[model samples]
Target: MFNWKRSSVIISASVFLLTACGGGGSSSSDTNNNPTPDAELTAQQQALTDIANAVIPVLQNSNNQALSLANAIDAYCDEVAISSANVASTLATAQSTWQAAMTAWQQAEVMNFGPSFDGGNNSIRERIYSWPAKSSCFVDGALVDYDDDTAGFDINSQTPRRIGLDALEYLLYSNDLDHTCSTDSSTTSPTNGAWNIRTDADRSLARCEYAKIVANDVAAQITALLDDWQGAGDNYFQQLSTAGSTSSRYSSATEALNEISDALFYLDTEVKDMKIAEPAGISADCASTSCPETVESTYANQSLANIKANLQGFLAVLNNGMDDLLEDAGQGNIASTMTTDINAAIANIDNFGTTLVASVTGINEADCTNSTSDNRLEEACALHADVKKVTDVLKTDFVTALTLAIPQSAEGDND
Candidate 1:
């Protein structure tokens, strides 16, 4: 989720204006027909504009991938309805499509501003791919409801927990028909006990049907999100590139640049803490040392894949124009250093050589420490440390150099 508050006081516009003028921005002249060829968008302005450009294709590709997933799910459900012998094969195709969609959306995760953050309480992104706040229990209950009252229940009207990629994962991956909720939970009680009475094939069919509905809903939401960014709705790309103009939502180009920088912080908390730390047992959330169940895409076992996609998104923003901005500000070393660290983290993740769950399991049982001789655990911990190196600069010097504020979620975080 996004933090409404910014930790540091935003730098005044006057200072930013001075910084921009001193930097390598183009200045129009009546006397000279040709301005200096070196003159161009300031690093800050360029960063802002670059993201606006990048987001369009990111959203478009994500929407296309989602549509593919929906089509695949439709075929899978069709097979299920007829008890086709090719049910498993069709289901595999759907799962593969889901993974592709997930990869595309994961890249879009870093481009989390404008339509993705504005009205409806981030419902658009949530509808497409809710995670870290999802509930299998709610999905289970919704499954029963969708199965029992097919005509009455609408997946489009469901909450994020009940209908998203996470729910689809449960439907497509988990073979278990048992409710995830406890007996005390309404989902597991007599009112919804019909879930358990069904045969395995019946449960599979119901889950597939539910998955098809959820996939369609996800595809619709992705289209809506894409339209919001495109000219069809807000034309956020223009608003972002033309920031500081009356038409743009941003009061200044600096504010627009800050928005993109703030989006990058998602790598710190979500990528570093929630995705890696909690699952690896280093973060406070995992008191037992390792909680593999909390890993993103637990059912699909795409945790490592998700992290890799997150890095790709992170680099998408950092490489866009932030590095040039740093260089113009004489902070090029910061850019080089953090880029190296980010690449190191990626290398560690790539070299881990196995699933995240398997790596966590390899940790020393006695101490729950990542220092074990097990190369997998060491490599996982190395990845965490590598990421922290990049984020450490993000929270301090990067924000200081750019005059951007630290997100409230990272305000007091020392690690």
Candidate 2:
């Protein structure tokens, strides 16, 4: 969920580039004797090129999903403005569209280097899906101040917390019973009692408008990202596949490999540690018990699905890009082991009895320790251990076999 975002801190590409270039040398005469053909693709180079090619279509599909989500949100907002009677059905459709987009987003998260990592000030990734720092209070304030002309607030001016997928979750799924408009003017505000005394319909309309703005922003940002990656002449995909070329960001094939390999740590740090361990009370952040409120997509009850999507994304990157190279390097066992670990982790998440929130909501905090006999807590602990196995292989054996350096940002993250 929100945990994945923090794991994406930018690493210095120069360090990896220097390491990659250190071992390679050829004299001018040697190069002249055997001028490498422009079209020649070494095993590692070919694997990276193939990965770049494969990612284009995956990103295209994700952009399409984002567009669909934006359209569905707009449609739902339009309907809410007209008739409140079918709000439930319309909201359901909108939520479904959001889920589809979320699925694609989770997949794209695995490939979160390059275009997604803007330097300094602003980040495209944050614009699309800021979480863990989500603030419903900000969303509530935006809705309450929708008509405030002096505030000059629109979705564009809203903070990350107020205008991303999490905000939409709050608007769509929270307190569904009170979502409908009430004719009575004395009803309390759904978000907080201090807000204006508007009818339920008024609140719904405001929330719908905010949701639409957030959806449109997400769609626009994703479209721009896709363009940066695959657009006509300004394509970064070519830059990635052509590492060591003058125009590419990476100075060697191994540098590019390092970037992709570093991305795998997201599964270890964010998914296993922040997403599951913190909530399961196995990590330092959670001192004694499961923290249901820390779970992502809690309002939508889609935390389990998010975890599965993350594993699916990780598997895609490994299978599509690294498997053949690993086999050729005599490290095929590592790939197989990682694949099995990811699959088993997905199964653990699937078998977890209920929604993340429901599973931890009423459990005694004292009984939520890692060794507690509580079935739900125990299952959660087991899932964390399972994911750790995958990370251990990737961070240690995989990096060594490939001769790739772990990104500095990911170093020393013992957990």
Question: Which pairs clash inside model 1?
Answer: 281-289
**Candidate 2 — what's its lDDT?**
0.67
CA deviation > 4 Å runs, candidate 2: 1-41, 144-157, 176-194, 362-377
Local error of candidate 2 at 340, Å? 1.5
User: Tens-digit lDDT track for model 1 on 62-81?
Assistant: 87888999999999889999
lDDT of each: 0.71, 0.67
Residue 142 of model 1, lDDT score: 83
Q: Which stretches of candidate 1 lie over 4 Å from their true place?
A: 1-43, 120-122, 184-193, 365-377
For candidate 1, the TM-score is 0.85
lDDT of 2 by residue, 33-82 (tens): 22254422355556666556545555666677778888888888888899
